[model samples]
Target: MTYTSLMFALFCLVLLLVYYVVPKKFQWIVLLIGSVAFYLCSGVKYILYVVITAFTTYITAMLAHKNKREFSEKLPQLKETLSADELHAAVKKNERKSRAFMLCAVAVDLGILIVLKYLDFVLSNINTFLPEGSALPLFSFVLPLGLSFYTFSAVGYVVDVNRGKYEPERNFAKFFLYLTYFPQIIQGPIPRFEQLAPQLFGEHKAEYKNLRNGYQLVLWGLFKKMVIADSVAAIVGAMLKNTSVLSGLELWLGMFVWGIQLYADFSGGIDVSRGVSQMFGITLDINFKRPYFALNLTDYWNRWHISLGNWLKDYFFYPVAFSKGYAKINKYTKKKFGKFFAKTVPVGILSLILFTIIGIWHGANWGEVLFGVFNGVVILISTLCEPLFVKIRKRLHMEERVFFRIFRSVRTFLIITIARVISLPSNIAIAGSMLLTMFGIRSSGTSFFAFTGQMVQAGDLKMYLPALFGCILLFVVSFLEEKGNSVRDMINAKPMFVRVAIASVGTVIIILFGAYGIGYVASNFIYSNY
Candidate 1:
């Protein structure tokens, strides 16, 4: 069921009731049952995919950890009986066994994800070059829900276990719970087993504060998804359809609105996920941190999609950047291109590669590829020019200025909006041409105010009004939070009547202005597909 659906509400209520009523030690079992129930609701046949992932990762991690343990127990004996070289070889042999397990698990998980999610794209591209009637038939495998999120998490766990970050979980049931925890299965913060497992298996009581904060957070997320994102989704769709007739400003405007919808919808879903988990006394990672307030691509990425970015940095980026192969490339760059490129270019190149993976990870499309490349290049150039930008800002005394800070934020947002166009539409070429067309365009001779009026007139203002107003409220709340004010805490500090009144009002507004009441269409959260 959808997060905002009545059925989901009842499901959660029933689970929560049983969750608190059950024995302290058995609470996790209750939660696992709930998770399985949620999984079954999506589709029963897809259960095999999860089973395979859990089995492979669990078996691999257990075996890898077992190898290490066995080696550890034999270490003293080897040291006493063997020569230095022989001892080194013995240790290396054990290490190889563990490494093999880690790689095999990673390959299996990634293989499943690649085949289910991207194999069709590969086959389609291949078919384009084949003899007309001899093209490979597409398998069209359905991706299990949360395949990308869970695979990353599972692989991360296996890699960590192999690296001795923590002991591999011995209990299959507990490890399975970590993977299928219902709240994050849809759109995850990609929990670490070391961090989330104990909390998952730990006993939880029905604390009043958790119940209050959680329910409030859920309501807030619904407000964003329903009132803001869903309301504006229609406008984004209409603008995409009419892009051929639209002026450059109109297309740019649509992209700007899309940036809002993207943030609201994705972050809104994360909020709900974290909120639900919070009620269980489990804290999911904070996935967003006022991303719009970021000053550059680096800062923007650091704030936006914090979980995945951190995951990539920890499990992907650093590993490649710190690899022996990269070290050799660095040495060669230092010799040929001087120290500056050695210091910066390698990282710039690495960042580009990392971000391109991120872009490709979003979807298996040429548009997404271009989107990643565009972002990667921007980051590369931005890194190379950072010193120049600093000099310019310092010379002009602009770095510390309030207006300049606003300018940078706005500039970064425009760049992000431009990148959105490359992927947000069905036709990437048209989108590319649309951006290029902006440079040489004759103005429509319409004032900005007139253009905005046209935007409102393009769709039902009733739909537009809520979205626009909600964005304003969102900005205000975010601004306050950025300034270190907790809006929820502020409300909680008020009298009981005040808190209830606020929650009631927020819930009623969501119901009335949400997709249910408005002409706006309710769709799945955008990131759920990924």
Candidate 2:
């Protein structure tokens, strides 16, 4: 269900009442039942897909864990009987078997994701080069909800077990709950098995602080999604639909608005998930960190989708960077060029690969692939030119002034906003043409604000003004947050009456300004599809 829907609100309310009312030990059971029920509501057929993924990974991890236990037990015996070299070989063989088990788990889960989500894209690409009318037909596979997210999480779990980082969970039920935790089963911060499973199974008493902070986060998320994001969605949708007829100024405006809409929708959904989990006295990782305020492309990445970046770094980038092949390349570069070039060049190239994979992780389309490549290329160039940039800064004798920081932040924001076009459109060519159109060409020499005025007129001032106000409020909150101030903490520290007054005002704002109800359809979070 969409997070903004009334059904979802009611569902959370019921879950909360039952959760705290039940015996503390039974809290986990309630969560499991609720998660299964929620997944069932999406589609019975699709539920099987996630179940199979969870089941396969769990069994494989258990087998790997069993082997690890056996090896540990036998190692002492082997030390007494075998020579040092022989013992080493035997241990290596055992480790190889463990890796094979991990690979099996990865293959099954990733294989399912590829077939369901990317088989059509692969077929179409092959069809482009085929003889006329001789192309293979594509499969009409229905993608399971959050297939990539859960698959990656499950794979990470099994890999961790193989690496002996953590033992495979012995209780099947708890493991299933970790895989299918309802709040994160849609878009995710992609929790690690060890980090999240214990919380899911642990017992906790109902706490006032948890409830208060949880609801506050939920309300704040609603304001962002409903008031700020949804308000801009209308204009963005219109501009995209009629790109051919849109003025250059309108096209640029759409891109800017889309950047806002996407951030709000994705981050807002994450906030709701965190809020709900917090009510149960669980905390998820923070996903966004005022990404628009980033001073460079690297900093932007570090802030935006923080969890995903961490996942890719740990699981993908680091592995490739330290792999034998990359090591060889590093040595060659160091010998041929110098130390500085070798140190950064291999990392830059590997980072590019990591980003391309990230892009493909987004969708089955070529546009998404290009989007990933674009980001990878930009980041790679920045890394390669770091020395030159450092020299330039030294020559200019630049100070770390607030105005300079703002300029850097604005520059980074615009770069990301433009890069976002590839992911926003169905076709890459159309997005490219729109970008070109936005540069200088305008229909009938219309001013930029004139097109903006037309959007305001179409939306009516009542709708338009609130959206503008919401953006302003969003900026203020983000600014405070970037400065490490917690508005929630500030509110919580107030007197009971003052806290109630603040809560009441927040409720009133949402009731009056939220873009939902009879005339509006709830939009799914943007990242849910991924």
Candidate 3:
């Protein structure tokens, strides 16, 4: 169930009550049941997908572990007498089983993901070269929510188990809770087994602190999502749907608003997820910081979707850069081109490939593919030119000045906006046209005043004002949050009565003014589609 929904909120409250009342040892069972109930509420069919994935990985890891033990037992006689070379062979044999297990897990998870998420796109492409009458019929498939997220987590767990980084979970129910935790089922910061497994199996008694802090976080996230994102979404949706009729200023405004909407929508989801988990005395990973305040693309990524970026770095970039072929190329470049160029070239190539994968991971569409390539190019160019830029700054003696820093920040934001525009477009052609229009090389009669008038005529002005105000409020709050001030801590530091009053008012505001179950219940977060 979606964390933002009333159904989920009520469900969590009931689960929380039952959890604390149950015996300490049975807490995991309570959680397992709750998770199952949560997924079943989504529909029984979706639960099958979750169960199939959980059991498949569980069985594979068990077999892999068994194989390793058997091999170790067989080599016990030689362990005390064998030479280093013989021991190496035995180790290699054991590693092969682990590798095979990981391969199977990856194959199954990716196979399901592709069939469920991209089969239609594939069939449509195939039909392009065939006769009109021979076109393939499209069939509908209901993708299980958070399949992309949980699949990655499941694969990461099995790979970690194979690598001996974490032991395979022996209890089926505990493992199931890890995969289908209600808070993270809809969207995720993609928890690792090492991070989440202990909590799943631990005895978690409810705390007053957890309740207060968790509710505060949930309320704050609601403010961002309903007050800020929903309002901006109204404008962004209108502009995008009628982009052909928009002018340059109107288009840019819409793009800017879209950027805000995306940040609020995605980060709001993270906050709500974290808060819900917190209520259960579980701490999930922090997924966002004040990314817009970042001084460069690299900084932006570090603050935004911190989990996914780290995963890509660890799983994709590191392997590519450290591969034998990559090392050989690096050594060759160092010998032929000199040390300075060699040091940077390999990493740049690896970064490009990783970012491209990042783009494709978002979707199978050409727009996403191009978006990934666009980000990769931006990051690579920034990396390559960084030293040059630093050198120029040093020569000008502007490195330490506030003005230079501000200038650098502005440049970074613009680059990020351009990259995100490419990422968010419906198709490659529209993205290309937008880029052309952005560069002012194409003449388009899209005017800001005209679009503003159109928006007012369409009854968007009333909602737009509060959303704009909310955006400003969010920025101020985020600025404080970035400075390391905790909003919850600030509220708690006040008198108890004050805290209660603030929370009560926040709840009332959310109920009266929140976007859901009113004019915008049909709208979902942008990333939910991914």
- For lDDT, the strongest prediction is 1
Local accuracy of candidate 1 as per-residue lDDT tens digits, 48-142? 88889999999999999999999999999989999999999999999999999999999999999999999999999999999989999999887
Q: Which residue pairs clash within candidate 2?
A: none
Our model 3 lands, by Cα RMSD against the true structure, at 2.2
lDDT of each: 0.87, 0.85, 0.79
lDDT of 3 by residue, 238-318 (tens): 766766666666667778878888889889888888888888889999999888888888898899888888877766678
User: Which 10 successive residues of model 1 have the least lDDT summed?
Assistant: 442-451
lDDT of 2 by residue, 279-384 (tens): 9888898999999999998899999888889988988887778799988999999999999989888888888888888889888898888888888899999988
Over all chains combined, what TM-score does candidate 3 have?
A: 0.94
Off by over 4 Å in 1: 440-459, 518-522
How close is every model to the real structure, measured as TM-score? Answer: 0.96, 0.96, 0.94
Clashes of 3: 3
- Model 3 scores worst on lDDT over the 10 consecutive residues at 447-456
User: Judged by lDDT against the true structure, how good is candidate 2?
Assistant: 0.85
